[model samples]
Each structure stands twice: as C-alpha cells, then as structure tokens.
Target: MTRQRYHHGDLRRALLSAAAEAIAESGVNSLSMRDLARRAGVSHAAPGHHFADKAGLLTALATDGFQQLAKALGTSRLASNSLLELGVTYLRFALAHRGTFEVMFRTDLYHAADPDLLAARQRAADALYAGMADLPDAPAVASEEVREVALAAWSMVHGFATLWLSGAFPDSAAEDPVEAARVILGRVFTLHAGVIPSPEAS
Candidate 1:
C-alpha cells in the first residue's frame, strides 16, 4: 500500500519531531532532510520549505534542545543538596534528549552562530548561573565568582553526562550510571563547595 502523504497543517513541527526521533535512533550523522521528509510522510522537497538545509534543521534542533534544557534547569530547586539536585537535572536532560544533546554541542555538525541557537544557549547558561547563586550557603559573592563556579559546575555535569553516554565507566562502580553520576557529581561539587570529601566515599 502507498504510504499516506503528509498533509498536516503544521508540517514544521511534524518535521522537527520526526528529525529528533531519527537522530535519536541513528545518531546525528545519519540524519538527513530527505529521510526526515520521508519520516514525516512529506515530499522530499517539503523539508526545504521549512529548513533550507540539514544545517538549518540541526540548528533548529539545537535551539530547541537548549530551550528545553533551560526549562529543566530553571525548575530544578535546591533542597539542602543544591549541587546534587541541579547536576542530576542536567544529566537527566542530556540522557533524555540524547540526540538533540549530541547535536547541540557538535559545532561541526550545526551552525554554531545561528541567532536562535545563541539565544537559547544564553538562556540555558543563565539558568545554571541562577541555580548556583541560589545555593543556601552560597555567600554574597561577586558575579564573576558566581560565573566561575557556574562554569565549573556546568563542565563537571556535562563531562559526566558525555562520559556516561560514551560508556566510559567501569562496572565495579558504574553498574548504575545514575547512581554513579549522583555520587561522583555530588562528591566533586561537595569538594568545590569547600567540604573535604574522603576519597573512599567517592
């Protein structure tokens, strides 16, 4: 039987959603406009009307990923364990949207300077900074100091997520990535927060 053609009112949304699924299942390198068109049941040329090229499509996906990440980070609260909670949320977002997360950081795959991508990225960054500033014991620090801490925290969480996704952990301790991430991230940030962590605990 012939596949039903895409005749929806919002082809843009449909194409984006399809592209996301395609990337998640096949990785960013395998995503293509033609494949997305077929996935969405639209003519191969239909994607062109919405996205000029694959770069445009991936740029849009990256923009969407950052916006969603900002929301995830924004709503994450600091119960007594501030860094652990915030870092967990960051890891969750990456693991949940593995495809978009992969494309969002690979500057070589997408237009890194796209205006929408920049705005979304800024919001995500701002959310992290705000999360750091809200820590209970966090002092009345300079913005620069807060910025430095935020960058470090982001690096640590991003590194953990990237490494976990790459299966870089060993079984003796990494039998569970989530638990391992929580312990590893909590310990590392606890140290950064001026608490002397016992290496054995880590």
Candidate 2:
C-alpha cells in the first residue's frame, strides 16, 4: 500500500485513529506500529515519532478513552442527575467505543504507571462517583459508606458493559442493550434504596 503523507501536526491523531480501527477489525494483539502507519498513509517510522512503541500508542489511546468517558458521564449527570442515566451512559460509551474500551482496562497492554493515563483514569472514576453523590438518597457527606455505594455502582455497570461487549449476553437481552441495562441497573438501585442510612436512622 502507498504511504499517505500527514500534515505537520496530524500524524499523531491519524495514527491513533488508525490504531483504533485496526483494533476493532482484529484485536490488540495483532496491532503493530508499522500496520498503523500504513493505515494512516505515513511511513512506518512516522508512528514511532509520536508513539515510542506499541504500549505507548495503547497508553495514549486509553487516556483518550478515559477523557471521553468522563465527559460523557459529566454530560449525563448534568442533564438527568440520575444514577441510572449515568450507568446507561457508561454502557453506551463502551459499546460505541469498543476498540478503546477493550484497551482501557487491560493494564498488561500498556504502561499502567503513566502519569497522564493515571490522571485520565481518575477523571473517569470521579465522574462515576460524582453521579452517585448526586443521587437524592446519597449520604450527606463523603464517607466510607458513600465510597462503598459508589464502588458497588461502578462494579455493576462496569461488569455489565464488559459482558455485553464480549457477546456474553443471549440474543434476547442483546437485542436492546440500552433497555436491558436500564432494567438491570434500575433493579439494582431499587434493591438498595436508601442504601446509606440517614442521620436520623443512626
């Protein structure tokens, strides 16, 4: 394939976009800087100029994914202020950005200790936890109880997204993932209504 030339500052973005496409088509294991360069219409070395290696590229991709996820969650929180809505948004992000979602959690695939990656991951986490606190029944202050509730909520949504993406759901449930997720997540919140005991109760 003929190499395509990239503008002065477009190569990095082009390479990242190509890498996502390649991961979606094949898998992370099959992705290579050389292949990404070809897909982006640049010299093989072009990718290296931006990303030192495969891990570097994947790290950058994961960072971008986390930032995007955080923004989506923040938007949902503002528009609906509903925990269920936040959970649904999480699922939607995962399915829509399958390639990035697949790479985001696989620590073995990238430099897990990278500062930017860690910061981005924290931003996404904070968004989810903030939604929990926005709930009407949330604790009055940030405490161990609040953290526990947030963790449970995160686990449930994250698990559902992972399972859905891996094709683990049957045809019936898979037909409408958003609705299915809504029902499932709704029940979870309902089951744990008033999860954090009120001050009056204590």
Candidate 3:
C-alpha cells in the first residue's frame, strides 16, 4: 500500500517526529529512513526529499537537539543560580529527549563535520560553559579555570544522566533519579557565595 503525507503539509516535521519516536522505542543505530517514512504515513521516498540519507536525518535530529539544549541551559539563568540548578536542568533535558541527547554526543552515528551540526554543537557547549560563573571559588573572568570547571560540571551531569538512564541505580538504592542527581551534584559543586554542608557532613 502507498503511504501519503500528513494533511498539514509538513513532511520534514512528520518524518522527524517519527524518527524521534522510533529512536526512543529502539535506538539511533536501529532507526531506518524507510521505517520513519512508514511511521509518518508517507511514501518510502517521501523522507528523501528533506534528507539526503540516514546521515542527513540524524544530522537534522542532532542539530535540533543542540539548539533545544542551548535554550534549556539558557532558561532563567542568573549569577545567583547554583550549579545544582544547572546540573538538574541538564539532566532534565537529557531525560526529556533521550534519543536526540544520545545522538548529539555520539559523533560516530552522524556526520560530525556537518557545518550546521558543528554550529549547533558549539551553541550547546557555550550554554554549558555558561555555568562556570556559578563556581564558588573561581576567579573573576578566569578563562582557564572556567573552562576546567565547565568541563567538570558537564562531565558530572553527563555521567549521572548516562548512568541513570541505563538503570544503573536500583529502586531499592535510589528511586528518584533527578533528586539523586541533585544530591550528588550538590555535594560536588556549589554556587558563588552560597554555602552548603560538605559531602562528608551530609
């Protein structure tokens, strides 16, 4: 049977929507353009119009992920915001878009050299780096230390999200991943001028 486009006439959106659902159901490595077309109720060749190939579709998804992540990181940001908030927000974004979040970092799955992808990636990185100002003892405009702390913060949240989504934490040990993430991040990082009990004390 032949498939047809959505009545709203947004084939690209429809295909991307289907791809996201498919990725969530399976994974990026398992996503197929033909499968996406079928899910979107479009003809087999319909997805080809907006994307050249599977790489093209994945590239689009990765790009979208980065742009949205940047926005997420930028939301209600302030010098008063703690590393805990930033890290929590990062985890939230990851949990919300598990599939795109997965593909955004795994360059092996998509075209890492794509110009748009590179720009969007940088935007997301910049957003993450924005959290540097929250470091308690970092010097003002400390570019090197900011970069280091930013890397540490990113690593902390990234690692926590990866593990939580993998079901590494058992329900008996810790049921709420977000709270667990907050508690863990709270111990490791703090905001400027904000005081919290040391991890050892908690």
Candidate 4:
C-alpha cells in the first residue's frame, strides 16, 4: 500500500523542527533531505515543496533561529538588565539548541545571501544592541566606545559558550554553563565601564 503524506497546516515548521533535531544529533554535514522528511513523517517530496534543497532548509532554519534568539534576548523588560540577561539567554539558547545555533551562525552551510535570512540575522543583532540603550549613561559614550564595549562583551560570552560546548573547559567547571556565563559576564561588564568614557556631569 502507498503511504499517505502529511498535508496538515504548518508543515514547513514541522520540517524545520525535525531538521533541527537531526542536525543536533549528527551535525549538519550528516543531515539529508530524505532524513528530514523521514523524521517529519512526511514523504520525501514534501520537504522539497517547502525548501528546494538542503541549503534552502538551512537558510530557513538560520532565519528562524535568529528571530527566535532575538525574542529570547529581548524578553527581559529592563533595558539596564538586558545586556547581561541577553548574554545569559544567548548561552542558554545555544546550549539548549545546539543544532539550530550551529547552523544559524555557519554562513557557509546556508544561503546567507537570502534577503530574509540576512535581515533576520541583522534584526537579532539590532535587538541585542537596542538593549544597550537602556544603560544608565550610554548616550554620553562615543559610538566607538559603545562598539568596543559591545564587542568585548560579545567576545567574552561567545568564547565561553564556544569553549564549554567544544569541551575545552575543565570537567570540574560547573555543569550549568549558563550560570557560569552569567557570573562571568556580570564581572566582565561591571568593570568594563572603567575602560569606556565616563559620562559627563549633568
């Protein structure tokens, strides 16, 4: 008997979800279109209907990953609290969604030139920086100062997460990497002000 195909609403999302899982389990290099379709409980052609190929699927995943990450980072209401919170959230998301996180940042795996994907990635970064505006005395800092601070913070958290995920950290390090990231980021950003311009007196 011929197997029935899925036609339910939101098949695209379902496929992406399945694809993320597959990537997480075996890495992007091992993921295949047929594998995704199998995991999604759909016919092989169904994935093609939504995403023409593996590259297309990866592009969509990257776009979706950025949008979701932006939302996660922006969930904190207080702007003053956003920077640290966003960094924590970023590390948490990466640790939890390793597959999606890896593909989202690897431009070579996806069609990064796609306008929608590029825009989504930009929006993610913009949201992160916007949170910085909530700083108590940010405007007084020069543009370069802000960039320098932001890059430094990004580097610290990004490096920590990468090292933890890559198994470069000591086993004795706390298993909860997110907590470690928060503590480290807090210490780093707090002292970072001294490195930047002091706000002018009111």
Tell me model 1's lDDT, rounded to 2 decimals.
Answer: 0.79
Stretches off by above 4 angstroms in model 1 are 1-8, 78-81, 137-142, 172-174, 197-202
For candidate 3, write residues 1-202 as lDDT tens digits: 2233455467887777778788888988799988998887777888878999998888999999899988888873554355677788889888888888878888887899999999998998888787566544432455667887778778978999988877786772556778887777776665422355555567
TM per candidate: 0.86, 0.88, 0.84, 0.84
Ranking by lDDT: 2, 1, 3, 4
Q: Each model's C-alpha lDDT? A: 0.79, 0.84, 0.77, 0.76
Q: Per-residue lDDT for 10 in model 2?
A: 74
Report lDDT (Cα) of residue 80, candidate 4: 36
Residue 156 Cα positional deviation in candidate 3, in Å, after optimal superposition: 0.7
- Pairs of residues at least 3 apart in sequence or in different chains that clash in candidate 1: none
Judge candidate 4 at residue 143 and give its lDDT: 60
Q: What number of clashing residue pairs does each candidate have, in the order they appear?
A: 0, 1, 0, 0
Tens-digit lDDT string for candidate 1 (76-167): 85344366778889998988888888888888988998888999999998888884666863434566699887788789889998888876
In model 4, which runs have C-alpha deviations exceeding 4 angstroms?
1-5, 77-80, 131-133, 136-140, 172-174, 195-202
Q: Write the per-residue lDDT of candidate 2 for residues 123-150, one digit (tens) a residue.
A: 9988878747657644344655777888
C-alpha RMSD (angstroms) for model 3: 3.7
lDDT score, candidate 2, position 47: 79
Maximum-TM-score candidate: 2
